[model samples]
Target chain A: MRNMLLLAQFEVKKMLFNPRGVIALAAFSLVWLLILLYPIRGASEFLISPDYKALIEGLFGPEVVSELFKWSVAELAIYWIAALYLFPLFSIFIAADQFSSDKARGTFRFLTLRASRESIFFGRFIGHMTIQTILVSLTVLATIVLAVSREATLLMPAIGSGALVIVNLVIVLLPYTALMAILSLYANSARQATIYAILIWAAMSITIAIINNYLPIISELKWILPGSQISLMINTQGLGSFAYAPVALLQTLVLLLLGRIYIKRSAI
Target chain B: MRLIECKDLSKSYGSKQALKQVDLTLDAGAPIALVGPNGAGKTTLFSLLCGYITPTTGEVSLLGHKPGDAALLGRVASLPQDATLDPNFDILTQLILFGTLQGFSKKEAKSEALRVLSLVDLAGSASQKPKSLSHGMAKRVAIAQSLIGSPEIVLLDEPTAGLDPANAKKIRELVRELSSKTTFIISSHNLDELEKLCGQVLYLELGQLTQSVSMDDSQQSQYLTLTMQQCDSEKLLNGVMELADISSIEKKQHNEFLIKHNSEEDYAIESALFTLFKQNSWQYKAILKGRTLEDKLFS
Candidate 1:
């Protein structure tokens, strides 16, 4: 347990505290700032306007659009559409090279000498989650503040709903980040991991679409693409906040287990 | 008690075997030198010992536990052949992280890093990034990292490979000083340095340990290399031939002779030769014991 924590501490410092990490985080924060202050705020206003209300109702169905009047739930609709898609993209760039760069530079030679292989693998995974939490927290805070300004009495409920938004968004990224961790094990460098991440995402999406037509029985295999259940997690479809949480958690555990096996046997 | 035990340990990558059928048992607190040519399995053996790689054919143990086991967490450490530090962090910060993994508290870890830096003569370079330091300085910092938490078994592969002569000598001295507390398995191509530092020598070739010599008992004192003035060579050799302890003498180099005596401790022969050289007015240089590692390996 202590070794795991120590590895996590080093991993966090590598991804969030270094100069490159600082630059990446800075750029990400700027993008999130724009997201919170502009489109996110604008989407809420436009969806409720009479000109677009019918359009949104028709697109999303009247039952789902009716919940937008409730301040606690309205922001989730905007937050989901804005943050959920952007979160996975943001995650790929931030954690693309987490494991690969260490191997490329021979740093793992020293690391594996003292710490257990499992500690290093899981520590890096947890460390990526930590960055995910930080980014999520800041974005949610800005969105809640914007929601509170437009409706003063909605502050308390906004906090609760905002908490749900961050949890759901973060959970949705876990399996994806876990897959990236696995990618890094095979990649030569972080840059290669980043490139592989985008290519793999597109390739998997195409494969899932193509295979679904002929092999409908294995439709559930689409979940391997990561973030496939984002809509289920955000739950604009009337499922509970945690309906997809267990599946995401299960996928994350399975990917992490595979990573542990690979790292143990693979040459550092 | 055996601090390390390996029986028929072997490792292979694809068809290339790095180590084969190796066997060894060692106790604690003795500095052992590993001498070998490049690609001679020195690094592979160190990796297996430190748990970076597992043996393919045999079992191995460190401090009576598996090499990578948690029981040996603070007890074993290594200064790998590669000195690549994370260019992002300063030396002190990295050492603190290493110290933390070795089980020191944050504050204690910092102090320990500071202490080790001081040991390696890099007290002022604590805040310096690894990229900012020269290869030699970076190597020292890497050495300092291994010394953290006062590890009992420290495996150093070419610890001073890139250092200047002076720094290399100092690191040797540091190893000698630390030998009292830590058991060191140092692999280096510098036989002279190893001869001066190590108590035992293990010669590895073609993925196998060919010979192991205990340096303390290496010199049998029956032979000595005697160097005298060029003009006095004949006179000194002829005079020394008269000594009662002498068995045979051969002129190896100009004014140098390889003298074989009758006993392991040739004190009587040495004293007799001193008198003979003084009488003949020959400048006597050094009268030393049997062959060095280089001589043994080459011969």
Candidate 2:
């Protein structure tokens, strides 16, 4: 436990303090800030609009669509979709260098001398998750503050929705971070690792689409891909929100184990 | 005591065998020099001993425990050759992290790192990023980290390979000072420096252990090399021919003689030859006892 925490501490410091980390965060914050300031600010005006209501209803279905007419529900729904889609995409770039950069520079040579291979891999995985949690939480809090400021009665639901979004975002991040960590083991450079991660995702998504069209029964093979449960996670409300939680957790553990095994078996 | 025991230890990467089966035991305190050519399994052996890679056939036990055992955390340290520092962290930050990993508290780790940085004469460079430092500076920092917590055994592969003369000398001096408490297995192509620092020599050739002898035995040889500026092959041989301590003298080259002494103490023989050379007004370079490591290993 101590070893894991120490490695995690070092990993966290590296992410927040390094120049590359700072640049990535600054860029993400700029784009995230624009979304929060522009579209999120107009949620109250849009919730009262009848045409937007039909459109929201058409997209999300009548079950959750009526809830979208409320300001808190609309902000949560928009942010949930953003978190489902955009956050995982952002996670890949942010996590691209997590393990590969260290392996490339031979830093793991020093680390393995003290910490076990499992500690290093899991510690890095948890550290990346912590950062993503903080990012998602910040955006969720911003959404809640905007909703409560408009209609104070929406505070409780906004808080409830905010928590769900945070959980969903973190679940979405688990497999993506673990996938990048695995790629880092084989990729020669951080840039190559990032590009390879994107290529793998594209390839898997394409394969899943083709399978879905030809053989819908076997389309469940899509679960093999990381973050394949994001749609199920976002579309389901309350009890259904956690439907794919176990699968995401399973994929995270499996990828993390594979990464640890690779580092252990290979020569440092 | 950190005792290193290897029993038929072998390693192969698929079809290519790196280290053949070998057995050996080494005790702590003496500085052992690992002398080998390129592709001679020097780095491979270090990796196995440091637990960077596992052996294929046998085992390596350090301090009576397997390498990389949690029990050996602060007891064993290594300076891997060609391994660069992380470019992001400053030297102090990374070194302190290493120190802490060995079980030191944060404050204690910082203090240990500062002390080691001073030992390597890089006390002022602690705040410098690894990429900002010179190659030699980076190597010294690597050495400094290995010295953390006064490890019982240190495996240094080419510790002074690329350092400047002054820095190299400092490293040699530091190793010499630490030889009393630390068991160091240093692998380097610099035989002369290795000879000066190591009390024992272990030679590897073609992934096999060819020679293992004490440096003391290397110095106790009957042969001595003499270099004189105005030395004549015949004259120098004649000059020491009748000396009781001298058995025979052969001219290796101009101004050089390989003296075979008559079982006399090395200094007595060298003293007699020095007196003879002084009488003949023969200017000389140096009279070194025994063949150098290069001559013994390579020749």
Candidate 3:
């Protein structure tokens, strides 16, 4: 357990201190700031306008707009929605090189000499998760600060909703980061791992669509995919937003186990 | 203590057999050399010992534990051939991380890293990134990591392959100095280096790993090599052959000969040869005590 934590700390240092890691963090910050600026800060008036409210209701129906408005503040709702999608994609990028480049350079040979392969694999997974968590929390805090500036009365409520948003976003990112963990084992570079992820996601979507069309009996298989619960998450509110937590957790568990198996059998 | 033990070990990759069924044992003592040609099983055996890969068949043990066991993490370490340090990290941080994983405290790990760096004469480069250093320096840093925690056994694959002679000699000196308290299994193609350092040699070829042979008795040689300073080849050969108990003499070069003789006739053979040389007024360059590792392995 101690060795595992030590290895995880090393991974965090790599992501935070390395030149490549600094560039990645910078890119994430710039894009995240733009997202916060345009959607929440710049469009606040349009979002709360009467006609826009009507437009949303007319487009999706009263249920989604009512569910969206159920949040403590308007900005928090926008931040929650944007974050659910943004963080997962960012996670795929940040965690793509978790093991691939290390394996290529033979650093794992050095690591495995002092730590077990399982420890190295899981420690890196935890490290990437920790990084994504920090990123998500910072963005959520920024949105909350924005909410407080618009309405001081909403601070307590915004904090509550911000906490919930952080939880939901973290759960959503679990499977995505775990997917990259398994992919890193097979790829020789981060680019190859990212490409493999896109290919897998595309191939699975097409396969699921074909199955749903031809074999309607097995349409339930779509839920097995990593992001399949996002559509359901869109209309849920409060604790209901956690409805898909079990599914995300299951996907993460399965991918992590498979990754552990691969690392054990590999020659690195 | 036993350093390594393998019984009928074999390893295969799909259809290719990298190591055949072989049994071997090594005990704690002087350094051991792993020598073989390219495509030999030298690296494969090193991997098996370090538990980087599992054997396809048979059993292997290090410090009385199975290879790759958690119990052996700090007890065994290796410098795998051509493996590099992660270029993204500075040398000290990587070494400290290795030390912590081996069960040292953070403070202890730092000091240990510095100590090993000094051992390799690389203390000043600790804060520099691996890419900024030359290949030889980087190789020395890699060797330093293998020294962390003062492991009971270290497997070095091509430890000095790319190093300049001076740097290579420093590493050789380091290994020699450390061998008193640690067991080293070094794999390399440099026979002269291996001959100077290793007390035992394990020859691997075509997936077959043989039993360990003493460096002094690699060929069980009762032969000696003689180098002379410009002597008449005919007179030298004839004079040496007339000595009692001398088995055979072959001229290896213009002034050198390989002489094989009875194992029991040590003093008599040498005294007679010296008397022959003195009579012919022959000036000698060197009289090697035993056949070279090259002769033992190839001759």
Local distance difference test, per candidate?
0.82, 0.82, 0.87
- Candidate 3 DockQ vs. native: 0.86
DockQ of each: 0.58, 0.66, 0.86
Error of 2 at B276 (Å): 2.9
Q: Please identify model 3 stretches exceeding 4 Å from their true place.
A: B216-221, B253-255, B263-267
| Model 3 agreement with the true structure over A73-156: per-residue lDDT tens digits | 788777767777777778888889999988898888998878888998889988888888888898989888887888899899
Local accuracy of candidate 1 as per-residue lDDT tens digits, B104-125: 8999999999999999899999
Error of 2 at A184 (Å): 1.4
List TM-scores for all candidates, in order: 0.92, 0.92, 0.96
Identify the leading candidate in terms of lDDT. 3
Q: Give the Å error, residue B270, model 2.
A: 3.0
Higher-scoring candidate on TM-score, 1 or 2: 2
lDDT tens per residue, model 3, B1-299? 57789999999999999999978889999999988899888898889888888999999999999987898988898888878888888899889999989889999999999999999999999999988999899889989999998999999999999899999999999999999988999999999999999999888889897545687663445777888997989888888888877788888766778888875855666777788878888888988777767767775
Top candidate on DockQ is 3
Worst 10 residues of 3 chain B by lDDT: B211-220
Q: State how far residue B127 of model 3 sits from its true place (Å).
A: 1.1
Recovered share of real interface contacts in candidate 3: 0.89
